[model samples]
Target: MQTTISLEIQRYRPEQESEPVYQSYEVPLRKDWVILDALNYIKDNLDGSLSYRWSCRMGVCGSCGMMANGTPVLTCATFLETYAPGPIRVEPLINFPVIRDLIIDMSEFITKLKQMKPWIVREEEQPLSDGEYLQTPDQLTEYKQYSMCINCMLCYAACPIVGLEPGFLGPAAIALAQRYNFDNRDQGKKQRTEILKEDNGIYECTFVGECSIVCPKSVDPAGAIQRYKVAAAAEWWKSLLLPWGNR
Candidate 1:
């Protein structure tokens, strides 16, 4: 069995250099070690200056997402053995500004997520006596798939539209918008639809489908955008045909 593997990690220190560079480090090839483990090894034993973002070592936090061999993946979940016996290239997620060595600036993603209003939105809050909004199993299932997104942003890295059009709302955000739109308790679909109907919204996506492919949670953001498009078109036609009907 191979005793070690080489990792070509991208390094960027704004104070020292203007361009990003690859720095290679040899790490023990243990069966139980994931990419995050190798990175920790490098930071702890080899170089303390190496920087990255990670939390909850478990994959749930979604903070350890990065490009592993040019593919977006959760470093904590991708085992080093998968790319064994050779050099594996690791970089910060693309389509975002790198804040440091491996941490990309995620302010844009956060702003887009806020635009989607991921929480259940209601026009009027029911009185406390009315109790919490009740939802059946079927109602929950409507948006359950999209709710799985942990904001890993791997989908954005894999999306060509996002790379081509910075103004595009991106995959995860649109999917999350659908999550709220489909929620039985949410009444803000009209407002969200207006936002999504903009040029930078779902229409910008050519549906390359890589977003869904790279999603760690099977969020299927491409599908969500398509579904939204269909629904929006239907609503537009209905409004046009029946001016007397409530919008």
Candidate 2:
């Protein structure tokens, strides 16, 4: 059976126009084909001028994230059958400035990630003679879920907080921060609390639950942020209850 896939794609040509607009393309597609495949077909056969990003079609690389039918998803993982009743409206992820076509600029997210110190900091001055940092099964389970983030920025795309307040560190970075903060081998939670507890930190999250819903990886970023909030609040209470505890 021949299927016609209708795509209303967002477009911007810097040399020709000042603003971006939507352009339609109808292509014969296989029902089994993924949205990314149809996008590739359009780029190859219909419009060579179209621009987007994709790599490692297995969904691990996360380079192909776009608004598929108004939802933020990895194009490689989104099947045409998922939205088969009618036309699929494709656009760049919301709450971000469009660079061109399906591409949205992520410089702001990347820069914020660098400021949070997302990696583990070692306390020992000497090299590890133990070869590897040991972790209990429960300890691994604690942060293992948060560590699965692919940095796809889908949660950021789904985040209304980041859109409204640019200072908000957003989901992915906060999730990453939690990943390290929860790690058993890490001893930097005190230092790391500054970033996670600041104005744009966990407080910025209104518990909209959108971040957890749109997450493709099943990473509960909202939970991670909330866990940190509870911890920070308890620490605040501790400081008030016993001044010498923090001192």
Best by TM-score: 1
Model 2 quality (TM-score): 0.95
Query: What are the per-residue Cα lDDT tens digits for candidate 2 across 1-247?
Result: 4478788888887777798888998877677788888889999999999999999989798888888877899889988877775588888888888888788899988998887688887686446675777789999999999888898889988988988998999888888888988897887777778777888888999988888988888889998888888999998898899998754
Q: Total backbone clashes of model 2?
A: 0
Q: Which residue pairs does candidate 1 place in steric collision? A: none
Q: TM-score of every model?
A: 0.98, 0.95
Off-target runs (Cα >4 Å) in candidate 1 are none
Question: All candidates: CA RMSD in angstroms?
Answer: 1.0, 1.4
lDDT score for candidate 1 against the true structure: 0.94
| Position 143, candidate 2: lDDT | 92
Largest lDDT belongs to which candidate?
1
The alpha-carbon lDDT assigned to residue 197 of candidate 2 equals: 82
Clashing pairs in 2: none
